[model samples]
Target: MKNVKARYLFLAATGIAMVACREPATGKEHPPSHHAASITPAKAHNVALYQFAGTPPAMAALIQKGIMTKLKVAVQLMQGQPLPAMSFYKPRNRYIADSLLVYLRGQRPAACEKIIGLTTRDISTRKGEIENWGVLGLGSCPGTACVISSFRGGKGKVSESIFNRRMITLALHELGHTYGLPHCPDPVCLMIDAKGKMNLDEGESYCAKCKNKLLAQGVVTK
Candidate 1:
């Protein structure tokens, strides 16, 4: 795999706006049923969080809390299953993020309005000409499921505050996609596209326009 830092700088310098927290179609140009019929604005209340095996408990709790507080939704920690072996790309030693979304949606309960998968292992998806592009997270746009990983965010030298912020920012960003929010042009918005860079610190929260959109969708009360 290409070095993460180098790829980030390359994309940032090129000003290439790669999809952030977006999953390619579950099938050929069509999302899966769960994605297609995800919870509506008013129904987006309960969320199921799957802590995939090997993910840290503290991290999972933090994610759950972050989502609950930021999105103003109920988050329940469900039983975590093993990451699908089929999603693993042996050569890169990472899980296919799109496949992981499929797995996560399948595991969602009927009662939960949405679902998220958390893991420590690396996850990736295709980006432009490059196949198996590593990503911090991937969420189905206007769909029900998403996945995030700590492998990339926790790498290198970072303070605990920065690391925690990165994790929380990723969770909120992916969930924002599921709530039908697109990548925001505002640099400080939580929904800003990463554009193939590790600039989580640049995002503080949802911008006013994005927050108003979420408010209209009933995803967040405040």
Candidate 2:
């Protein structure tokens, strides 16, 4: 058996991007989902963020605006939807990340380039080549959907200020994948894997290398 690289994770109080599975960061091309549907946008930068019913609304609003301004994208804070029970993991009392992806795929807005669901529930994926428990989030590239959970950021352990930073960092990290970016080797870059040690650091913006790639791909102008 091939040795799987173990990603380090912080002890978050509650919660969780990327596909349910990840290939090694050796820059190999993984096949795209042939039936994956593209999301249309009201404008080039339009991004739709769906807040699942149980998530904290106030925090979600703040995240919506932050994403809009920071990434130079137009983020729409849509009405909350009840998380589907079909995604529930009875043992962990968490939802399955892929189920949310499947849900978001069907819920894309006509004027949005990507659709992301925000929830407070813990989420996980059981399909990685190696066992993965309690993931921070998951996203698929060239797909219109992704999701993030604030449940695991270790409630009350993180100061309001730092909590916000971590949320935005992971938000952009997963969103970057939706724009077809891979996990960056730079520890301080937003594209670093959330489970990486770098996330425990204070930086929240994309590194220059990633910023230029986004510009080149037309995912972001600024």
Candidate 3:
């Protein structure tokens, strides 16, 4: 009798332990029907270009206006949507490209799909590359977009009218670079070389080949 009682007690204890192990902690079980659908990847990106100081106020405004106007037109042409808001940042010192990138990361906006930095230095140029030794604006981590910088200066003292015209072309060019575009072969296109020219002549838009390229990238429509 004593042996049977001990055996019964051991069996009961094992059963209790097994039950406890199998049961999940309260509130830990996931809902059976609440699995969320994966978020669709973004096809187009909205970029915010931050301008650091050292650029003249008038020049900055011209750059901003030109970029905004061309970007709007580009979106319309592409049949794509624009970000609800685009912004600029002013830092006390020049070359705040890194700081601006850090700032955008902290904001954590879903709408701000990308961030681009516009500086007076050529990011692709060797000199600017050396200067940006410790910078992080070249690109973001995987699933994030890249950052592109452009240099737009030559003459020491350009007239206001000329600067304004130059701003229009430069803005379009830089924005094009941001959108994964390269310089066009066509001399008349806005994305053509700007070694000495200041602006694009009226009625000159993206060249046929460039337009086809943009269309392929879903950046422009027929």
Candidate 4:
């Protein structure tokens, strides 16, 4: 009798441990997992590109091409839109990236699965203790909207080609965030965090691990 009781208790404890391992606590900022994806109905992935007034048409086309080829997602180029004056931060002389995302989300067309706003204006978002912290771009994890800016890429008199490449890098990074990918540890991965340093030149492509994660989520093709 004593041996049976001990065995039962051990089994119960083991089962509890397994259950705990299977279900992590969910939160607003939690990255989506395969378990979450399983419950949601699968849908085709499509991206929409929006060129804000003042951004060059050539630059937007470059970014659109990158998304289409690398991400394997259909993209639609929307009509040019004016930048919202309310998003401008006079003190920083930059636009608020968070506000731009909200605007993009609201403006997102029904046919598009995700929307990205492109601009040449400097953009900023709150980071930790700093208000109006400048960033190359910003996006919501596992969300439908993102925004990128080329103002920082043109700095330091970089060659136009290099500057354009940086913009493409920024666009890819922000879009990766929208696909629920966090900063990758691989130094050369496109998803690597800028960490306020703007080292776009270092990123070549998504690391294998990051790409596999996207593959599992069906965001990237094999």
Best by lDDT: 1
Off by over 4 Å in 4: 1-42
Instruction: Kindly provide the TM-score of model 2 when superposed on the true structure, using C-alpha atoms.
Output: 0.76
Clashing pairs in 4: none
Task: Write down the worst ten-residue block by lDDT for model 3.
Answer: 13-22
TM-score of every candidate? 0.79, 0.76, 0.46, 0.78
**Could you give candidate 3's per-residue lDDT for residues 1-222 as a string of tens digits?**
223212211113221111001222467776655444564333543444444433444555555566555453211111112211222222312333333334434432344444444445332211223533322123322112233333444335676565466545655554554444555667778767544344444323667776665566454567
Per-residue lDDT over 89-166 for candidate 1, one digit per residue giving the tens place of the 0 to 100 score: 999999988888878878987767678999999998878788879999988666778888999896557987789889
Model 2 local distance difference test score: 0.69
List per-candidate RMSD values in Å: 9.9, 11.2, 21.1, 14.0
What tens-digit string does per-residue lDDT give for candidate 2 at 43-154? 4566788988977878788788778766767788887679998988887788988778888878877667778889888888654563436766777654567788887766
User: How many collisions per candidate?
Assistant: 0, 13, 0, 0
Q: Is candidate 1 or candidate 4 better by TM-score?
A: 1
Candidate 1 clashing pairs, residues 3+ apart or interchain: none
Query: Candidates sorted by TM-score, descending order?
Result: 1, 4, 2, 3
RMSD versus native structure for model 3: 21.1
lDDT of each: 0.78, 0.69, 0.41, 0.75
Error of 4 at 18 (Å): 27
Q: Pick the TM-score winner.
A: 1
Give me the runs in candidate 3 sitting further than 4 Å from their true place: 1-45, 73-110, 120-124, 127-158, 194-204, 216-222
